[model samples]
Target: MSTIIHASAAPKFPLPFSHAVRAGDLVYVAGQVGVDPQTLEPIGGIKEQTEQCIRNIEVILQEAGLTLDHIVKVTTHLARVEDQPEYNEVYAQMIKQPYPARITVFSGLGPYLIEMEVLAYAPSIRGE
Candidate 1:
């Protein structure tokens, strides 16, 4: 069985997708954009947007009774490759080391400068 996770305190973007889903022992979070929860607008610049993206992911994780510490893998998407360094600056602050396995891709990501999706491990829920 699987469960959909939703965070009431997170930004309510009108989308047909759950914040995260739990299948067996893993929690798979949707791609999180840099939109502010209060304003629902993309934050400015790569650094700020990266921070907001991480914050959004954090909210989803919290709703699942998990945290960044539970994350085992991460995938980041950037609108511009040049901002990779700036993205790293904020990302490094949000996720601790030994960091989760990660991959970064540069692509056109609508109005948002960056986004991220994560996979987290839940050992206690393996049989659920």
Candidate 2:
């Protein structure tokens, strides 16, 4: 059975989807943008946006009783290829050693400069 997860620390945009889904030992976090929690507005340049995206993902993980260290995989999308260097810098700083396997793509991402989704795992605690 799977359970939906939502983070109160993140923006509530009245979207139709849950922020993440937990199934057994794994949690699938949906793609997150750089929208500010207070204003619900997309943040500044790539660096700032990338930071916010990670922060948003962190909140989702928190709701699942997990942390960044639990992430096993990641998928990143970049609206502009030119911002790759800045994105990489921010990403590296946010996620520590023994990094999760990741795939990054440069594509049009609407109004956001960067976005990321993650898969994390932890031992099942439903019965305990």
Candidate 3:
């Protein structure tokens, strides 16, 4: 069976979509932009945005009783490919060693500089 997940602390999605969905042993998180939860406004530049995006994902994962350590894969969209170096610096600081498999590409993200989605492995954890 699958379950939809929501995080009260995460930014409200402008569109209709759950924060994440748990299916079997995996939790697939929706794409997260660098927006403040209360304001739902995109944050600063790529580095700051990257940090917020991961923080947003962390909140969603927390709702599922999971953490960044549980993530097995990641897909990111960057409005500018040139922002990669700064983005990678912040990512490395937050995601620890044995980093999740990741792929990043340049894409038009409207007003946002970065957006990220993650897949986590959680064979034992359950959502409330």
lDDT of each: 0.88, 0.89, 0.91
Clashing pairs in 2: none
Q: Could you give candidate 3's per-residue lDDT for residues 1-128 as a string of tens digits?
A: 99999999999866999999999989999999998888989888888888999999999999999988888899999999899999999999999677888999999999999999999999632231
Give the alpha carbon lDDT tens digit for every residue of 66-108 in model 1: 9888888999999998999999989889888778889999888
lDDT of 2 by residue, 3-61 (tens): 99989997777778889999998999998999898788999999999999999999989
Against the true structure, whose lDDT is highest? 3
Stretches of candidate 3 above 4 Å error? 124-128
Off by over 4 Å in 1: 124-128
- Model 3 has a clash total of 0
Overall local distance difference test of candidate 3: 0.91
Q: What are the TM-scores, per candidate, against the unseen true structure?
A: 0.93, 0.92, 0.94
Q: Name the better of 2 and 3 by lDDT.
A: 3
Check candidate 1 and list the clashing pairs. none
